[model samples]
Target: MRKLLFEMAYDGSRYHGYQVQQNALSVAEVVQDAVEVVFKKREDIVGCSRTDAGVHASQYFFHMETALQIPPEAAVIALNNCLPGDIAMLSCTEIPPDKAADFHARYSVCWKEYVYKIWNSKVKNPFLQDRAYQVKYPVDAELLDRCAREFIGTHDFRGFCSAGAKPTENYTRTIYRAGVHREGDLIEFRVAGDGFLYNMVRIMVGTLLLAAEGKLKEGDVTRVLASLDREQAGITAPAAGLYLNWVSYTPFGEENPVK
Candidate 1:
């Protein structure tokens, strides 16, 4: 068996999400179908992450094991050619059997970066309507940045996670970076962390915005963190504004990690 590590990106507007769903189209199903068209058949195409409905991925990783000995460059060409315009395969790497025996895409990751985009202007930009969360209320950019700082460092994120998410003893995760960046009217909230719970990033972004709008009081974020209560946090932001920005992976037990 030959293991193929593949990278792809998608504009998620037309699909439900990354995973296959019953009675709905998905990015993974579309990619697998395109692969079948090119490679005849392939199995065990494992995805690295599960993105929510309508959330975009600037890049995503998955793996497949097949008997075919297709070259990486040829595989990339064939898959891209077969895929629709919104989804395209970017790279393919064939791992030697010795290495493939141990590599698991999802568990080998060292960190992931998720970005949330917000269009804070009163006037909407037609181009960014689908790409960003547009809010008519005036946002205090500085306040948003200040409030986001509370999320930095390791903390129990049970308060930020959505309800009905499976209970786990280790709800703690590290936030290496969390901040707000503004490009004209487009405000981007970038958070890079070791890992995330379900809906964690969206809820964090929502809490920061709530502080800006006075729905949540100043220094309330620290209280929310200490309280470990989801009710104390802000509303969950819409899925359209969330993006799985990029995932940085490291070879197990190694000093240098690969992007």
Candidate 2:
């Protein structure tokens, strides 16, 4: 009878993805069961994003309708106690009655941020084994930043998405923030946009890595975006290196701030 919104983070090393699949463990499935244990049976549970296998999330959201009369704050604590160690509930909110009736986790999203982590070191990093990409080659952070900024504005990102993914006529997306940073051996590629196609962030990181290493082909970044060809881009970065860093929703009645 009421909708509850919860933000969470999960280590995607084990589950298949966010959504549930037959014969596969999933983050949503675990959370859904935990919520059922704490609350009355839910009409449905919905997540904000559909992450690929081996991908991690530092921040995520889900909303569900249930008949339980428990407070949102109380539900958060109870759900965390029931969920796995890798997944933790950050907070819980009760959507306004007016919005609850119409709100959707996926369709209402305004923007999302994805981060690709790379440990640029000759030696392997034990701490970040499955959490980040360990590259033996030398990657200049300045070069990466320069190349990354090229993708800051809106463009057709068809080349940055996975070739195997479903087709879409609208390949254009607006990037709000795009940058690369380095600290010691840790290199982070951060990108925030109105939305993204499947595997778009990973492909962009792969192309940026080539530019950082001075291996990018002529007219790569811009030409690739215009060509709308997946093969023109670099390799698909490993899923383990990608993270759903953050998500933001547009206020009711306002359009997505695409820029």
Candidate 3:
């Protein structure tokens, strides 16, 4: 058996989510079906993360074991031909089976980056209507940036996460970077963190939006962090504006600690 890694991108507007479900089309199911067409057998494809419904991904990854010995580039082309128009495979690589194991071991992800887009114009752009959140009210970009800064570093993020999340002993995660910026009429909230809880990024963006709209005080984020209570946070932003930008891992050339 050989391990094949696929780097794929998809527009998630039409699918239920990444994971497969009964009576619903999903990104995973689409890819798995393509794999079955190529290999003529059931294959296990493991995704890096399970994005919620209506969420999108620009650079998502998954790994599967296959007995086929096709070249990586050929496999990519063949898979793309079989996949639906909304999903496309950017690249494929054959890695040592041990490398595949290393990729998943211990959740050693260095960080994950996500972008939330807001259309901050009086009239929404038709091109981005489905991709961005439409917020007509004037947003103070400077104030939103200040609010974003408060989320950096380790903190109990219970307030910023959604309810119904499984219990965890620790709610703290490190934010390597967090910033709010604008391009033309689009407001973008970009954050990179070691890990995130359910709805954490969306809630953080929602809280920042409240600050931008003058509904929440500038220091309210700090108080919310201290509160460690979900009710203190703003409403969970819509999932349509969220995108899994990328996932980073340790350099492949680095020496393996276990080897």
Candidate 1 TM-score over all chains jointly: 0.94
lDDT against true structure, model 2? 0.85
List runs of model 1 lying over 4 Å from the truth.
Answer: 251-256
Candidates in order have lDDT scores of: 0.85, 0.85, 0.84
Residues 88-152 of candidate 1 have per-residue lDDT tens digits of: 78888786678788777787677888889999888978887668999888787777887787788
2 against 3, candidate with superior TM-score: 2
Clashes of each: 0, 0, 0
lDDT of 3 by residue, 1-259 (tens): 8877788999899989999999998999999999999877879898878888899998888888888888999988999999989899998877666676666522645677899999998895889855889899889887898889889889989888777788888899889889999888899999988889989999998889879778787778888889998887888999889998977665323344221
The segments of candidate 3 whose C-alpha lies over 4 angstroms from its true place after superposition are: 105-108, 251-259
In angstroms, give how far residue 190 of model 1 lies from its true place: 0.4
On the 0 to 100 scale, the lDDT of residue 52 in model 3 is 87
Worst 10 residues of 2 by lDDT: 250-259
